[model samples]
Target: MFKSILVAVDGSEIGHRALEEALAVARVMDASVHAIHVVQTGTYPTLILSELEPPDIAQQALLDALDREANEFLADAEREAAAAGIRMTVYKRWGHPGAEITALAQELGADLTVVGSHGRGRLDRFFLGSVSSYVVDHATSTVMVVRG
Candidate 1:
């Protein structure tokens, strides 16, 4: 019996599937959805300028690109929620995604959290640890993981 559902998105096809599944479930339950994208300040900054004496312009451009991507992630989720006829909320956090998504679900008092089985990995179950696994292990709320 979820009243508020929080779903994490990372712009991956799997992430989109998670969003769609969350929307469908929420629609059936008449639950409000909270869609979030966490921008973990990981190697992204370093990738901007891997060379010795990094270019400032490159660093700035990378930051700008990250910002644009974050916005697009949130906006797309919002649109999906609307199209599904579900009430929705959006959030962006910059830090450890696992911690942030877990914290936000608790902070928002969500009854459940939904996330993708793997983010950006076509063979995720074999490749790497995914955001879904982290959420399932860390979140206090009930989690529904959707596989793509």
Candidate 2:
């Protein structure tokens, strides 16, 4: 019986599907849902060119934009959970998505963690890396991967 469900949402359609799946499971189990949106800080590369603006300013701008997007999608998830009469908590973290999600799942002692997969081929996953795969491999709790 799942009492605490953790879901990772990134504003992607697949992410939304993952949320939906989590919500459904939470509803069935009468569990609390915890949603996390991780802004992948490692994805951005430092620009060494002198023509570019200061690194601090550029980094801040990028963080700000990512924060806005995270808030938007999290808000939507909250509303959807509310409509379903489920208790949902939202969290935002800055780091590698896979690490953050697994850490939060442990911190919250989540019974299950749900994530979405793009279902990309081997080559695509090799190049792009897969958050869902990472979670499945790293999370201490049970993991559910919903393919897009």
Q: For residues 119-143, what per-residue lDDT tens digits would candidate 1 score against the true structure?
A: 6635445645466778889888799
Candidate 1, superposed: residue stretches over 4 Å from native: 45-55, 121-127
Tens digit per residue, CA lDDT, model 2, 1-148: 9999999887777888999999999989999999998877665675232455655887667767878988998999999999989879999997778889999999999999998885223443564547777888999989999886
Using Cα atoms with residue i matched to residue i, what is each candidate's TM-score against the true structure? 0.85, 0.86
Task: For residue 34, give model 2's deviation from the true position in Å.
Answer: 0.2
Residue 84 displacement in candidate 2 (angstroms): 1.0
| TM-score of candidate 2 to 2 decimals | 0.86
Model 2 Cα displacement at 133 (Å)? 1.0
Separately for all candidates shown, the number of backbone clashes (residues 3 or more apart, or on different chains) is 0, 0
